[model samples]
Target: MTLAFTCKKCDTRNIYKISRVAYYQGIVICTCSGCQSRHLIADNKGLLDFPEFGRNIEDYMESQGESVQRLVLSNTGVSTQDSSTRLSPDDSGNES
Candidate 1:
């Protein structure tokens, strides 16, 4: 699924292609290609509770106009450094 949101650091519009599996995970970390700043995307009740997450993001994107940067989420995990690096469920950055 595709997600669109504005970067808080750079104010640049970003579009991310997220995997459906990510919804099951605890947290999702998104990096803005424009400023290389990282943004955390998460749902307190968990993404499973909100099936419309993708749709909501799409709506926000449409309302914001054009998106300048695009990123794709890998099946294994979100790559913060290299392709070999994968963030497991334990590394979701959530202590809870």
Candidate 2:
């Protein structure tokens, strides 16, 4: 099975080839192919959720060490920047 999610940094669609059981783990890490940014998805006490961009997901994972398994997914295609979800330090940061 494959899990799909948008990259928070570049808004690219990241697809991971993982089993259903792995998808429901306490935490899941995915590296974006477009911008190479690390994303952290966690289970907030039974609430499965994916954190947004600029949340320092990688920092948290690094702290976890081997306790967490990093799942690096591949991109099925090229990424066209999504204006609605681009991570820009500037105001709006919408790329035209």
Q: In candidate 1, which residue pairs clash?
A: none
Q: Model 1 misses residue 60 by how many Å?
A: 15
Number of colliding residue pairs in each model:
0, 0
* Candidate 1 lDDT, 24-47, residue by residue in tens: 444566899899997655543444
Query: What digit string (tens of lDDT, one per residue) describes model 2 on residues 1-96?
Result: 455667757889988765455445445567888998976654433443434322233344566562323333234332223322333234455666
Q: Which regions in candidate 1 have their CA more than 4 angstroms from the true location?
A: 43-96
Highest TM-score model number: 1
Error of 1 at 63 (Å): 20
Off by over 4 Å in 2: 44-96
What is the C-alpha local distance difference test score of candidate 2? Answer: 0.51
Clashes of 2: 0
The TM-score of candidate 1 is 0.41
